[model samples]
Target: MSAVIEVVSVINAATGTVFDLERDVDVHAESLAGSRETATTTTGRRQLTLGDEVTFRARHFGLRWRMTSRISAYNRPHHFVDEQTRGPFRALRHEHHFEDLGDGRTRMTDRMTIRAPFGPVGAVTTRIVLAPYLKRLLTKRAVHIKRLAEQVG
Candidate 1:
């Protein structure tokens, strides 16, 4: 079974600024500092664009994981999609959407779809453990991004 997780965050910054921060590799690393995540390939510290691929190394659940993701879709400050080429999960897709609130704020939403590796057992584990863990991780990342974007604006 595949698990889909959605996380929404409101940022007190412009949509463009929020979108830029979302694709900034350096900001991602900083936001996920607790996971010790790093961009191991591509334009290491640059913003990701369509057709750009990045490999990330991170420690999760007491294990080191590596995932290569490609920018499958891009549409300025509106939305973008990243799909995993290779990763710990059997499959992974993350879609980021940004909505301008028309008052210097943006509503950012992350919709992630993930499939585990071990078939039925993995599906059960994903539902019991992975889902909550990922939700928390996503929440933390969003909060960090919001703080950074707000600070810069």
Candidate 2:
């Protein structure tokens, strides 16, 4: 079975503005508050588009890893999805969603599905990782984003 982790947080920023922030790859990296280190192509464009290939180097739980992903889906100021082309997981799919809370706040959710490379051993890996740990990581990331967005204006 594949392991899935979903985390949601409320960002005290306009829904539209928050949505725009997620669309820019650089912004997303920055909102993580230096948690991720990235490099771009010769074009030097930070905004992401459907089918764009991007590479990211980030540390999670003190473990540094690199991921090369392609933007599998993009739908303007609403939601976007990315899938890993080359990385640790046998399969990795991430979906970013934004919802309005009717008070200038945005509810942002991250849904991640990962299939570890070691087959049944991956199931054991998931158990070891625990959903709560993954949730905490996402929560920390959201907090950083919330602070950044709220402070921007």
Candidate 3:
């Protein structure tokens, strides 16, 4: 079974600016500093574009993990999709959407679908634990991006 998590954030910045920050590897690293996350591949330090792949290393749930994901779809300041090629999860897909709310505000939505590795038990644990954890992580990332984008905007 696959667990899905969705998060929405409203930023007081332009959609384009927020979109750029979402694709910036450095900004992402900073936002996830608590996890000591780092980019371990060639595209880790650069802004992600279509077909770009980045490998990330981080400590989560007291365990270190490495995941490599690629930019599967990109539509400029509107939306983008990234899917995991290798990771702890059996499968993972994240979609980010940005909407212009007018008057310098943007609504960002993150939708994720992830399947854990342990079959039924993994699915149960994902629903009880991992899903909420990921939602919080996404929330924190969005808040950080909002602050940064507002400062620049």
lDDT of 3 by residue, 1-153 (tens): 988899999999999999999998888889999999987546545789899998889999899999999999999999999999998999999999999999999999999999999988999999999999999999999999999999998
TM per candidate: 0.96, 0.83, 0.96
> Model 2, 1-153: lDDT tens per residue?
677889888888887777666666676676555556563532457777788878878787688878888889988667889898988778889888998887788889989887787778777877577456666666776776777778762
Report the Cα lDDT for candidate 2: 0.75
Shift of residue 15 alpha carbon in model 2, Å: 1.6
| lDDT tens digits, residue span 1-153, model 1 | 899999999899999999999998888889899999998547654899998999988999899999999999999999999999998889999999999998899999999999999999999999999988998988998999899889986
| Candidate 1 vs. true structure, TM-score | 0.96
Model 2 TM: 0.83
Clashing pairs in 2: none
Off by over 4 Å in 3: none
**Candidate 1 collision pairs:** none
Answer with 1 or 2, whichever has the higher lDDT: 1
